[model samples]
Target: MVVLFVVAASVFGLSSEGVRDAVDDVGPLAPLVFIAFSAALTVACVPGPLLAGAAGLLFGTALGTPTAIASATLGATAAALISRRFGASALDELSGRRVTALQDWIAARGFLAVLYARILPAVPYNLVNYAAGLTRVPLAVFAAATAVGCAPRAFAYVALGGSLDDLGSPEAIVAFSVLIGMALVGLLFAARDVRAARAARREG
Candidate 1:
């Protein structure tokens, strides 16, 4: 199902340019196409940063950020749902003892776990969604954290996309570095927590 979603998204994205041109030739369909593609990309695990950036690039900030939020939220929700349904086998296969132990710690931390995973870029977005699904994290809390935590990273991409004129310039590099730094900090914290948990587990 995940593979299917990715294939579908790729097909849709490939035709996006033609679709946009068609909408321009016709009328009133441009926004619809943008929303649909954004949603599809999100569901397909194409990466929120890339999607947000594309949204800003295509629509500009005023329209782009809102569109990104809407489409990304929908996509993320759908992906979580799908992961909830088909995640058991894949998760069990991907996660070893260490990962499972880490998940246990996350369950203890609840919303904070979700928050950290959402904030950190080291964790694959799809994997986090699936991992959360496997735990007892409440849907509301999961959605809230995902929505809020995703904003900073998503907005950064959208901002960059909106300013494509500065692509490859020093400012763009600095902006990207800052975003990566923030993500790394969050990841480092999570890593520390994981290490502490492992030590405690070994001791106990």
Candidate 2:
């Protein structure tokens, strides 16, 4: 995680001009590097939003969106596996009730939970990945949902970043608006689930 953070910070610090220069200089390698950095960032718990935005700024829509999705999915899967192997007990100890509720919810709707969590920005990406690891959700299901769920946001970021020529352009504003709407919808569903779980627990 520490290593991941360092890599992410370095990537995030690149100036827009620097990013464009690097892309021009390195050409094809830029997407590969961006993907690698994005994976590391996700593992380090760097915010997904930052990564998505950076992908756009660095690679543009054509390459950035796919790179972000692939990197994020891989990073998330790796994090989930590692958390399950080494940090499950610790996580359970720290977030017992919430974890239990999440576990139950995942069991009931494993794919949907993964999809919703990925789609929404309400919960940190790392937390959701780790939580899924602690649950009994199938790996294939988790991976598939994660890949699909991350697409919209990833594309949005790439689109926003690609439109940098006109910083305040209608395209950028529309993309940002769409991202916010998706995030809000995800949060609403998550909140409803949490509330239902709490109510059930109280009733029981």
Candidate 3:
């Protein structure tokens, strides 16, 4: 599915706008096409916010959030596994201080590490997938964390996107609130992780 999407995306130059056009081209298979294209773009580390907006433009908030979550999880898992298979050995050879420190931190925290990464808006979603691939975290743990941790933000983004025309709508207001809440919670997690990392270094 990913490969197929990639090929179609290559032909269409997939973006949020492009996705809509592509979906229009395939009336009955729009749902599958959306997920496939989104996942492919994600695995390629080529698109982000635009894809969520496309989800809203196509399916509205109710259906868009679930589809976005599904695509994101699938794409993240595929990217991580690809990196694990092909890039881990290469990355493990480099022991740069920052690299080693992050590896140790993530390896120590496992699922929580991924959950934190997913929620923290500052963290790049695609980068974490690749980085986690190089770590000892299990694939199951990675996928589960990605799904759960990303849900809130996914819903928020899709809802906001769906309500783009009516920024003052109830749905838009609620979506903004959700984004703000997630950002605050993510910051708390980040602060805790930083403190823990410092303490661990001192212990070692």
Candidate 4:
């Protein structure tokens, strides 16, 4: 993993401009290629933020946001399904009353739980996918929540990517500010929800 990160960093340079230049060399098919790569990377536990930024740098906000969202959703869902299939034995071994109750709660509020998880940066995207798979949350609910929850953050990253060349401009400043605000608000809400859930669990 360390070697892979070093290699990727060396090749990609960890900047929107570098990614843009790399994508531009591919011409018209860049979007498709980037989206494909984003999906693959998500499964490999690569952070979605970088891919979102790359999409923005490669395609700009208008095209980039939707592309990033779609690619991310697809990748997360794929990971969940794969984990469900392959990790069933391990999951079965861990099953118990508390686990069943938690699963029931998540299954009942799957969309909201997932939405909050995605909205808050606390939940790592790859980890969330595998976690959801371990529960009984419906795939459709998981997909929907992930799509909705991931949009704001994805947009923020895309915007940042789109504004990379003009970071000093008002557009870039606004984009950065918006992303920060949304992240904070999401974090606050997620914390509140977690507290409430814990209280309820204790009472039960």
lDDT of 4 by residue, 80-169 (tens): 888888885687787888877887898888898888778776667789988888877888889999999888878877777777666666
Off by over 4 Å in 3: 1-28, 94-105, 194-204
On TM-score, the stronger of 1 and 3 is: 3
Considering every candidate listed, which one attains the maximal TM-score? 4
Question: How well is each residue in 60-157 modelled by candidate 3, as lDDT tens digits?
Answer: 78888988888888889999999999988888797688887888888889998899788897898889988889998999999999999888878877
Instruction: Report residue 66 deviation for candidate 3 (angstroms).
Output: 0.4
Could you tell which candidate, 2 or 3, scores higher by lDDT?
3
Q: lDDT for each of the candidates?
A: 0.69, 0.76, 0.79, 0.79
- TM-score list, all predictions: 0.67, 0.75, 0.77, 0.82
Report the C-alpha lDDT of model 1 over 14-132, residue by residue, as the tens digit: 33344335546756656567778887877777877777776665665666677777777677667777776787557768889987887678668877778887777677876776567
**Which is better, 2 or 4, measured by TM-score?**
4
lDDT of 2 by residue, 131-194 (tens): 7888878877888899998888778776676665554777677777878888788878878989
2 or 4, which is superior by lDDT? 4
Error of 1 at 176 (Å): 2.3
Worst 10 residues of 1 by lDDT: 1-10
RMSD of each: 6.8, 5.5, 6.7, 4.1
